[model samples]
Target: MMRKLRNILLTLLLLAIVALTAGSFFLLNHALRPADNKGRDTEGSYAYMFQTYPFLRPWVDSLRRAGALCDTFITSADGTRLHALYARATRPTRRSAVIVHGYKDCAVRMLMIGYLYHHDLGFNILLPDLYGAGQSGGDYIRMGWLDRYDVIRWTCVADELFGPEATIAVHGISMGAATTMMVAGEKQRADVRCFVEDCGYTSVWDEFAKELRAQYGLPEMPLLYTTSMLCRARYGWDFLQASSLAQVAASELPIFFIHGEADDYVPTEMVHPLYEAKRRGGRELWIAPGSAHALSYHDHRAEYTARVRAFVRRYM
Candidate 1:
């Protein structure tokens, strides 16, 4: 009887493993499949979520009623309707700044910077919901590769709304930071005044490696690397090659690179080398002593705000 019970338990374990494997595959397939642009479009997903989770509607409504904030839509080159928020300073300054949020985070989390620049420093802010996040278009998270185009579109929108002569500065955290870096490297983004990148990874592959090691205790190069390669082959874009460190190092634009000394998510070591590479140019690197990943802003709020304000004040 005991032998039979043990055998049953082993079979159940095998079945559980199979179920988990199948579920993971199904979730991945759903995530990567892009929605058709015509009838079943990306915007429909946002509408469904808004209807199901009505709490977000009130939060967005409150931000709009705050007087200084204006919500707008941006259309990507591929006709994707991206959602963005523009905050005008009460004092009406010509200097404009754009803030982009990271993965799984919407433009609402960027309100902290908008409040600082718009109210405290009297600078206008343009905050956009990045692709695959918030009210933006896309299904799967492409990290920062395709998000670069979304950044460019919003920058153009800002230029049109604020005029060509308005000095534009960009501030981003995590994935947004990577997107900002990629955008700054583009020749069309030259009108940007300065850039602020906080806690951004050096490459998408390295980030995946770190995450995989944490979860599975296995080398990510062989598995995650191969998976990303397959994703690129399927999506027609290289996911592993998305990065801004090399491009930013060779650029003439002023850049402020900030990272937490204790950041384990995308180690400061990866960013440190790039920061060192750009030391000769218009660059400033700040590593907060006790911060971790995205917590650098909260850990050293005063210093972070002061340094960012100083940079923008100089360029803008």
Candidate 2:
């Protein structure tokens, strides 16, 4: 009877292990895989943007008609051909911006910010499509880990495209914001002036853990640990290693951190730690009242642009 009970316990343990392995794979796929609506159609995306922000239609149309808006491409270090939308300023200027899009968002989706810099502020802009989204090529999302390198490369491309004398700002929202912080940690060209991150999470691990809990009521123990290990083996990056907080701590360049007070998606609280982490260069934080997630600019367009214009000018 004792031997039978022992055999039963071993069988249950084996089944548990199998269940855990399967769960980890599913979790990894759910988090890293691209969404169905990845914004591949340029016209469709622009239409959506126009519907959401009515003012963009006329401004963007004018730029396109003027031949100031165009597409550009580059080969990444990994040999992936990346795509971006470049918009020249209405009038020639030394200021430029490399605006990054969030998760599952493409270059076209970020054209509002591009409009802010290119048309409103009279600064040229380059907006890149992060891998596996828009027109860029990749198998899976790297969160902000691998994308940071791609953004760094784009900054160089921006420097070349806008001229060496151009003072550039790297600005991103959500996942793109995380990418911007990661880029800040790395050595950058002198032309790269300051950074602006809006509603960015502290780290991939923390964000995933929050999502896991919120979605499935699961804790970050065996499941998250196993999933992270699987991610490292399959994609060359794990959640914990893709840390915006750690990267922010390492950066020496001035950074402007922006988050919406009502942001629960990335959690408004995450920005506090990231703001405190930056000890070098300089830092500023703005909690946009009643704004949600990446909607700070949407809700308070004039204020958002004004704050961004003021913050970047100090560093540039």
Candidate 3:
């Protein structure tokens, strides 16, 4: 009877091991591989934007009529084809902006920001569809770690398009904001002047750990550890190393940090560390009152525009 009990215990342990391994891979896949839309809905997206920001309709209509809204493409170092929407300023100028979209989001979703720079601020704008989102090609999302290299490449493209004398500011929201912070740490062209990141997390590990707790009520121990290892083996990056805090610390360029005071998705407090991480002299922080997540621009359009204009102008 004792021997029989030992055999049953061993069998249960084996089953538990299999279940744990399967569960880890399942979580990794679910997080990394979100639904892809391939940026198919230009008219639909514009309509949604117009409905959300009615003031933008006439301006976007004019841009469309003038043929200022254009598509551009580039191939990444990995040979993945990437797509971006670009528009020249009302007239030729050296001032430009590279606007990045967030996780599971496309360039079209960022047109409001594009309009801010292109129409309101009189600067050329380029909004790229990050890999695996919109029209860009990739197999999985690297959060912001791998996306940073793509954004850096787009800055070079934007500089060339705006001419040699161009001065550029990089702005991103959410995951794209994380990408912007990561890009800040890298060596970039002289034309790249400053960075603006809104509602970005300090690190992938932190964000995922928060989600794991909130959504699954699971602690970040064996599951996060196993999945991070799987991610490193497959995608060449781990959650702990994909850190915006560490990146901002290494950046020499000035940074403007924005966050919604009421934001809970990325959380309002995450911005404090990111703001404090940057070099003291070149950093600015703005916490929009009563706003949530990425809604700062939508909620306070005029103020957001004015602040961004003032900030970018100082550098560009």
Candidate 4:
């Protein structure tokens, strides 16, 4: 009986080891892969995910028409065709703004800002659906690496359409905001003036830390650190290097950091450090009193647009 029990214990141990390994592999794969709310493998799946998610659908159809939108397609460096939208000033305008949509959001969400600039302020607005999110091509999200490259292509298109000397500004919200900050960190020769980042996170690792704590009810640092390392090992992406906090701190360009006071997703504290770091770099930090992530504009419309316009007018 003792011998039989010993054999059963060993068998259970082996099975447990296999299960643990498979679970680790699955977790790491999800952490590394681009999160497509729209499933990548099927068009029908994409449509279903979009429609089922009420938070995102109405913006695509309603917001597109409200801005008098025009669509364009640009190929990425790897030959992926990206769908972009433009809401140009009805009359001539020298200032241009390129708006990037956040994770799970399409370019049309930026049309509210475009309407403000193009209609009210006569600034040409450009909005691109980032890779794996909307009509843009590509399967890997790469957090912000592949994204920054796409933004570079969009910048090239913007420069070509508007003259090289045209005043250019980039605006981003949440993931889009993080992408904008990362792209600004890159070397650009054009007179790229100001960046507007709303509810942007400090780093990929930090963002995932919040997710870990919220979902697993665990402390962030050690588990997140280990999972991030596993993510790098399994997927060849270094979350440590995927930090906009480091990038923005080192850049010469001026930035405007906007955050919602009641935000729990990215947290309001993330921007405080970024603000302190950018104190000497012509940066402005605005915190809306009672807004959530990406709702700063909706809560404080006049203040939000005024801050955005004033920042552009001052720097660009």
lDDT (CA) for every model shown? 0.72, 0.90, 0.90, 0.75
What lDDT, from 0 to 1, does candidate 1 have? 0.72
Give per-residue CA lDDT, model 3, range 1-316, as digits (tens): 9999999999999997898889789888888885554344556776777898887888878888999888899999999999999999998899999999887778988988988898899999999998887778887777989999999999989988889889999999999999999999998789999999989999999999998998999999888988898899988899999999999999999999999999988999999999888974399999999999999999999999999999999998
Give each model's clash number.
0, 0, 0, 0
Off by over 4 Å in 4: 1-21, 28-68, 219-235
Candidate 2 vs candidate 4, lDDT winner: 2
Candidate 2, 123-242: lDDT as tens digits:
899999988878888767778889999998888888888887989999999999999999999998889989999999999999999998999999999899999999999988888999
TM-score winner: 2
| Deviation of model 3 at 107, angstroms | 0.5
For candidate 4, what is the TM-score? 0.82
Per-candidate TM vs. native? 0.79, 0.97, 0.95, 0.82
Query: For residues 15-76, what per-residue lDDT tens digits would candidate 4 score against the true structure?
Result: 97676566556655565554555423335533653654444355445546676467789887
Count of backbone collisions in candidate 3: 0
Angstrom error at residue 150, model 2:
0.7
User: How much does candidate 2 score in TM-score?
Assistant: 0.97
Task: Give the 10-residue window scoring lowest on summed lDDT in candidate 1.
Answer: 33-42
Alpha carbon deviation, residue 51, candidate 3 (Å): 1.8
What lDDT is reached at residue 120 by model 2?
Answer: 73
Candidate 1 structure quality by residue, lDDT tens digits, 1-316: 9999999999999997676556444433543443432213335544543564454455445656876467799777678778987866666567888898876667766666666676557777798887666677766666777887778778778887777777788888888888777776776555677888888877776776777678678785445545665666666675457767766665667788899999988788877766766644488888989899877877777788898889888887
